[model samples]
Structure formats: structure tokens, C-alpha cells
Target: MAIQKQEFIERMKRLQASVRLSELEAFLVTAQDSIFYLTGVTYSPLERPFFILVRPDTGVVLLAPTLDRDHLASAPNVDEVRAYWDYPSPPGLGWSDGLLELVAGIRLLGVEPSLTQEIAQVISAWQPQAVPLIERLRLVKSADEVAMLRQAASYADLGMQKIIQAAYYGVSEIEIFSQGRAVQIQIIKETEFDPLNTSVLTAAWPARLGTQPHGVPSIADRLKDGPHIGLSFLRANGYAAECERTFFVTSPSQNMSEMFTLMLEARNRAFALIRPGVPCAEIDRAANGFLRQEGLGDYLLHRTGHGFGLGNHEGPWVAEGSPDVLEENMLISVEPGLYIPGLGGFRHSDTVLVTSDGYESLTRYPTEIEALTLLARRSMTRLRGALVRKAVGVA
Candidate 1:
């Protein structure tokens, strides 16, 4: 999906502004994500390298392989666009030949860290810049980026809803995973959004049975565990968000209810602390501290959350001792998890936009107890109730 002409212009302008201030004549972007962020083009980087050169006076130049030229056909801010037949140019030159030749005369060049060593060697003096220009610029969201993120989050929520609806005692993990992916794909098609990527996971048990934290669901694996976890992560173009919920294969025991209640409380506590100018570390501490107070600290595994946008896991991590500070319009996840060696991992995550004053949740899948009950009968009854309510116009 190509970014609007005006959005592309604004982005290049920002790059130019940064370049001018740094006394750099041009910015060389080699990172795939960086190029996608600046020009709304993505392809198989392995087959062919893509480069976006941004000059203070020349706007932007995109050098891509012929195979991916159509992705940039409608992109704006590209003052000059060129394409090579394939890598290892016909003249026996290297992959960096075309891009290096384009910016050969640049006195001082700005670069993203993803620049290959060979590419840097072609330049006169490759003094690496401190922070990646594109990543720094992407730390804050424009109105358009926020809109894309909102759309991605909506699809994630819808996928999660479908997952719980499909939950059953005998259902195979692969079955639910397929259904969830299909629903998200359907949403993208119906909404006229471009084809995107999604991850749907179903966990039948905790580490108690040596269940790996991350796994691909197998057709043979069924949801026979008392409770299972369903995680939905969706990406729209490059933007993405994640939502996770716990499902019970049968009626949850009193202890399971209590543990989940604690997890929800931890997630909420962390959510309340998100805002512009706050130290990102405190957010993690808030959740971690609460979990400790409830005697669940020992079960902590990863950080509270991480900033997300073009990259699912980016800067401003909500982890203990992190130095980054939160900023307005920064997208973050509030996923506080507790993993007991035998019981299972307890985690509930929601993507939120750090706003000017506070924060706004983007994912709105049902987190309440009634909706997450995995008991075959109870869940089916609720699903029927939802359908009935919709039919009666009172859902």
C-alpha cells in the first residue's frame, strides 16, 4: 500500500530538516522497514535490496529492483526513481553500486544503522550517526499513522473475538488458529484494506507440561487442558498491534479465576500510568510491583510491554530500568504476564495509544470473565446469546 502523496512529502521534509541540521547533504536509508515507513513500499529484501535516498534539496530518490517497481509507482516525494534489473548489476558491479553512485558526491551522508558494511565502505568516511534518523522520526506518530494503527488494532480485536467463539473442548489448536487467521483476512478484504499478515496462537497448557512459550499449533494438539490461551497479533502493511486472551477448556477453578483476576489488575495498573513525558520504566515497575505485592513477582517473565508501529517490537520498552521516556502518539502494549513453572502463564495484553493527556486503548475485545469462560457449554451459550441479541437489535 502506497502512502498518500502529501504524507510522503511531509516525511521527506522531516528527513530533509534533520539532514540540514546535521550538516548532511543526503540521507541513505537501507533498512527495509525504514524504506517502507518513508515510501510505503515493501518487497522481498533478500532477493533485491531497496534504498531510499533523501536529500535536503532533492526530496527523495528510490532505487529498487525491477521486480518491485510497481510498489513505488504512486508514491510521492520521489524526485527521481530508478530500478535495476536485479542484484549484481549487469556491469559486474556489486549490489551497492547503483545506490552509491547516486549519492557518490554527497559530502556528509546520514545513514540508518541497517546500511551494509559494503555500502558504507563505498562512501568516503562512514561516520555512523548516533540514532537512526528514520527510527527517531518514527518515534512519534502522525495523524495518518495513528489511523493505520487504529485499523490494525480493530482487526486484532475481531480476530480475538472469533477465536473465543470457536473455542471448544475437542477443537484442535490448528483449527482455531486457521479460523482466526481466516477471519482477519476476511476483515481486510471486506474493508478494502491491502492484504496483510497476522499471527493467531492457541496454547493448550502452561509450562507444567513443558509447553514452549512460543509454538506453532499442531493439528494433533487439542484443547483438552482446563484452560488455554489465545493470542491475536495483526499487521496492516507495516503497522501492527497485539491482543491476547485466556480461554478455559472447561469451567475454571476458583484458583484460576483468582490468578486471572490478579493478571487483569496488573494490566490495568500499568495502563493507568501511560502518558506523555513519563519514564517508560515506571510503567513496567507499576505492573511488576503490583504483581509482587500479590506474590506473583516470582513468576514474571518478560517486560510489561514494548513500543510498536512499523516494527512490532521497537523502542521505549516498558521494562525495569529502561531509560526511554514515553511520548505522545507513541503506540505501546500493556502485556503483563506471570509464568508459574507448573500452573501456566497468565497474560492479557492490549495495545494503547499514548495520548497528550493519558492513553486510549485500541484493542476492545472482551476481557471480562463472562466472555472468556472456555467451558464448552457456557461459551456456546454466550455465543448464541450474542447472535440472538444481534437478531433482536439489543446486542
Candidate 2:
């Protein structure tokens, strides 16, 4: 379900309250996600700038390009809508002019840390305070946001199922990736989902290529008798979730099995630490310490995980050196990995929600090695994948 209009209004109220407490005359929100959080409005500003000005007593005003004036009419909780001709216009009619006029009498202005330097220079005279008021508010998911994330997680699970079903001995990475995409397209066509806010992406990092944790999938890299990683990341409506797994077309060697076991254990350790009020860094430390003690520290790559919502990767980072603490309703991913050059990567990721007492795994695909191992034989999805690859001219 989409976030209700009332929720958006409540968010604006909270932001305005924060602005007043900070002693700022006005708060300018430039981040796209922050604007969406405040007013249920989505836009791809690209080079054109968009602003949401929140005043203590004046309510909310949106400064948008003239092209979007009509489109934004349906936006809820906005007290006023002002427009500029475009990005670069006559000195009196551009975005800068509109912005300056909006805050002309304000002595103190608060801006999001995401504001671009050029825009910052434009209002340098105000010496805008870079406050993370909106970001901090976003850290804890509302009941509505959690519902959207659950929907997104279900789609991610479906995509992962398609990916695993399509995998076979000679299947190329792109072929497997295409099968997941086809399912996503079909879902959008048949459901009430907003295509602009929904996306599903899959990748297969086969064999040695999996060592490059962030490597792009290649058509030439086919599944083999070794560890392979599959990733299914999607956002339904405005919320995001991810599901990833490490699988093998054939039985993994004993050593590879051992590595997978360690990786899973590390993830479990992190999961056991999730609860309201726990320091985010402690979760990472417990997981990292486990791997380091197992003599696999050299193979460790990135952080244990990170929070996700409107943006795929956001605040309340679940990593060493992070200052944020876990709070109820915060959604985070738990992924601890070990990447060995020739042996491939061993990692599994799931979107998890921090609950009052513990956590809930939203993307509940089979994580055990037995369930992940794909039989190297023909299947309907494999045949469909082959047809898709041929249609796309991928030999």
C-alpha cells in the first residue's frame, strides 16, 4: 500500500517542530527522498533543482520548475506551490530568484547535508546550518513504511526464486539475470504497482568473478561447478528491499562448504544482536570479530550491513565506527561476506527489520546450502532464459 496522505502531513509536522527547536527561521529540504517523505511527491529533478521550504508558522512551500506545477497539484500537505520558468532563465525568473525570495527575510536557515555546493554558495549569506533533521526522522520506519518494505521484500523473494530456478550448468549470468527481469515486468503489468517506483535487478557473479563483490554480471560468465552469487534487489512503490544468495550448480568442495558455513554463522551472529537501543557498531564488531578469529579476516570486504528505505543505502549504518544505534522499526540488511580470489564469494543478504525485542527477516528465501544448490539439468525457466538470450542477440 502507498503511504497515506496523513502520514506525509505528520512527517511535515515533525520536521517543522524540529526546525523551530533548532531556532531556524526556515528549513530548506533539497534531497529528493526528503521531499518525498514530506509531501508524497516524486520527481527526477536531474539538473533542475527542487526545494521544499518549511517555516515555523508559514507551513510548507514547494519551489519547482514550471513544468511540474500541474503535476504537483495533487501533492498533499503543501501550503503553497511556486514555480520558476526553468533551471537557467532570465535573472528575475530562475530557481535562484524564487529561492532567495522565499527566504529573503529569514535570518537563520537550515539545509539538508545533501544540498549541493553550488546551491549552498547561492545562500551562503544565511550561513545555513547543515542539519540532519529529516534523515534522523527517516531512520525509524513508520508502520506504513514497514508495510511498503514488506511488499517490496516479497517481490525480491519472487525475483530470487526465478533466478535460482533459471540456474543450470551452462546458463550464462545475463541469461539468469534476464529471467528475473521478465518476472518483474510481468508483475508490474498485472499489478497495481507504480512502474516508476518499482524496479527489480538480478546479477550472477560466477566463479572467480564473484571475488569482485561489486562486479557487473557478464554474458560470457556461465554457472559452473563452483560457488556463484545471485542478487535480487527491488523497490516496490517507494520502499526498497534486497535478497542475495550464494549457490552452486554442482556440489561445492568441502573447503567451499566450510567457508559458506563461516559466512552464514557471521550473519547469524549479527542477527542475534539486533534489537532496539543496541549500538549499530556493536553488531558489526561481533560479526567481524568472529570472522577474524576464524582466520578469515583477510578475506573480509565491506561492512556487515546498512539501513534501507526510500534510498537503497541510508543512515544508521551497521558497520564499525558508526555512531547510530538501532531503534525499533529500522530496516537494515545483514550481509557478511568472505571473498577469496579463486574460490568465489561466500555471502547471503536479507532485508531484516529491527523489532522491539529482536528482528524479522523479510526476504525469507531458502538460505541453507542444500536448498540453494541447483540441480544442473534442464528446466522450464532455463528454456525461457535461453529463448530470451537468443532474442537479445546474446550468443
Candidate 3:
């Protein structure tokens, strides 16, 4: 079943209670996810421009060009839908004027920084003291929010299963993307789940020597054979489960194989450490420790993972200097990768939900060395050419 309107209203009530504003008086949410979260509305109306205006105590308002008004009207929680003609744009105070008028008398106003510059300027002109309220409210996920994320992970698992079965030699990278995309669409149609847009497929090589983090190849190029390649995908809701595994087009060299194994161990160790009260920084260090022991420490890249929810990337990033404590209901990724120049890259990533005592992995693709080797064998020579280009001596 779809999220209830009453749930949304209750969320607003909580937001209202926190701010001590009987209602926000007015909150103009420009971030698409924020709009969806607050109003339970989901649609891409603004081909070029669109915005959501909410009066926490009063009602909801939608502003868009005439072309999209009909579609925007269907969004949940929208009470007064205002449409502005496109071709013959309204006079002096056209669409903006209507938006301005919608909240003309409101004293307190809130806005998301991601909102268009023009809209922010308008909101500033009307209420110079608008509060930065959106992020604070969105930073934490509720129970309904957790359920949505879990459902997205469920779909992602299904999509990955379909892609794994089809991942083979001679299939173009585009073909893999197509396969993953089709599976997601099919899942959406069959499960009646929310629409998803996320990293559905990937094939990336580590930088040179397979030892230096700085070694790199431009992803703009198409998929090729040789060095190690990694693939990660997600069947997204507003939230998603992101899982990744490396595959070799041919037998991985001894070093390449070892690197993959180490990365997997790091990820598993990190996963085991996940529980309420664990420090986020400690988790990053734990994974980084594995790379250090292997003498590939410098080549390690990015954070262990990050919070996944309404938006693909969220807060509580798993990295050094993080002050976040692992909390129940939090969903994140534990991906530790090793990238070296001249050699390809190795990474094993999975989405996980923190629990009271332990953690639950959302993306459970085969991470074992033998299983990965078989997948690489199935991929065949597509990886060789790519690896040869990265390393001068590879045959």
C-alpha cells in the first residue's frame, strides 16, 4: 500500500513541534526528494523548472508552467494547484508573482538550499530570514522511511540476480546496462514498487601498477577486456541498496586475485563491526587497516560507504573524522576498494542496515573468491584490451 496522507501530516506535525512554529507558516521545498518526503508526492513535472510550496498549518500549493499543471495536480497533498501559461507568459509578475502571492502574508518561511537560485532569491526577497529547515528534518529516517529503503533493496537484489545470469563475454557494457534497466522496470511493474533511479550497473578499472591510488582510466570510455573490472547495481526506491563485485575478463593475475580477496575480507570485517554504538570513524579505519597490511594502503579510495535512503547519497558517511554513532534503522554500504596504477581495481560493496545487536546485509551478491573468478571467466576477453591499455607490458 502507498504511504498514508495521515502519516505525512503527522511528520509535518513533528516538524512543527520541533521548530516551535505552530506550523512552518510556510515552507517552500525545492529538493525533489524533500518535496516527495513532505507531501508523499512523486512526479517529475519540472522539465526545466518546478517548485513545491507548503504551508505546514494551512495547506499545500504547487507551482509549474501550464504544460505540467495537470500532472502536478495529481501529486499527493496538493490542495491548490497553480499553473502559469507557457507560450504567452503572464505579464510583469507572471508565475513568480503567483508563487509570491501564495505565501504573501506568511511571516516565517523555510527553504532547501538545493532550490533553484531564482526561487531562493524570491523567497529571500519575501522573507529575508527564511530558515534552513529541510535538511534538519530529513537527516533522520522514520520507520516508514526504513521500510521504503528495505523494499528498494529487495528490488535491487532481484535486479542483480537477473544481471549476474546475463553477465557474459561479448555482451557490450551498454548491453549490461540494458539488462539491469529492464530488470528494474520489470520489478517495478510486477511489485508495484516506487520508481527507482540509481547506479544500476558499472565496470571500472583501478589505476596503474594496480598499486597507486592516483592511477586512473577515464570511465567515459566503453567497457573493454583485461585488468580487473567491478560491477555494482541498485534497484532504487527514493532509497536504494547498492552492491558491487569485481569480475575479470580472464584469469586474474596472482596479485589481482589477492587484492580482490583482501578487499572482500575488509568489507566483511567492517560488516561484522556494525552495530548500535559503534563509531563511524572506527569502521572506516577497520577497513582501511586491511589495505594497510597488504601494502596497498595509499591506493585505497573514497569512504567505506554512506547513508542510503530517500536520496542515493545521504549523511553519516563512513569515513575518518566522522562523529556519527551507528544507529538502528540506519542503512549504509560497506565497500572497501583497492585501486593501483598499471593494474585494474578491486572492490566489494554491499548495502547494510544497522541493527540493535548486529547488522543485516541488503545486497548479498556472491563475494567469495571462487564465485568472483567464475564470473570473470564468464566475462571472457572483454576485460583484456582494457587492462593492456592501462598497463604497458600486459599481453
Tell me the TM-score of each prediction against the true structure.
0.85, 0.96, 0.79
Q: After superposing candidate 3, which stretches have Cα over 4 Å from the reference?
A: 21-25, 54-57, 67-79, 105-108, 126-132, 168-171, 193-227, 235-237, 375-395
TM-score of 1: 0.85
**Of 1 and 3, the candidate ranking higher by TM-score:** 1
Summarize candidate 2's per-residue lDDT along 1-395 as a digit string, tens digits.
Answer: 57888998889899989998999999999988888778887667889998889998776888999999877767888888899999799989999999999889888999999899989989999999999999999999999899888888888888888888888887887787676666677667655676666777887788767678887767767788789988888777778899999999898999999999999999989999999999999999999889999999999889999998997788779999999999999999999999998788999999999999999999999999999887757777667767877887787
Q: Where does the lowest 10-residue lDDT sum fall in candidate 2?
A: 186-195
Sorted by lDDT, highest first, which candidate order results?
2, 1, 3
In model 1, which range of ten residues has the least summed lDDT? 202-211
- Give residue 258's error in model 1 in angstroms: 2.6
Candidate that scores best on lDDT: 2
Rank the models by TM-score, top first: 2, 1, 3
Tell me the number of clashing residue pairs for each predicted model. Answer: 0, 0, 22
**Residue 260 lDDT (model 1):** 81
Clashing pairs in 1: none
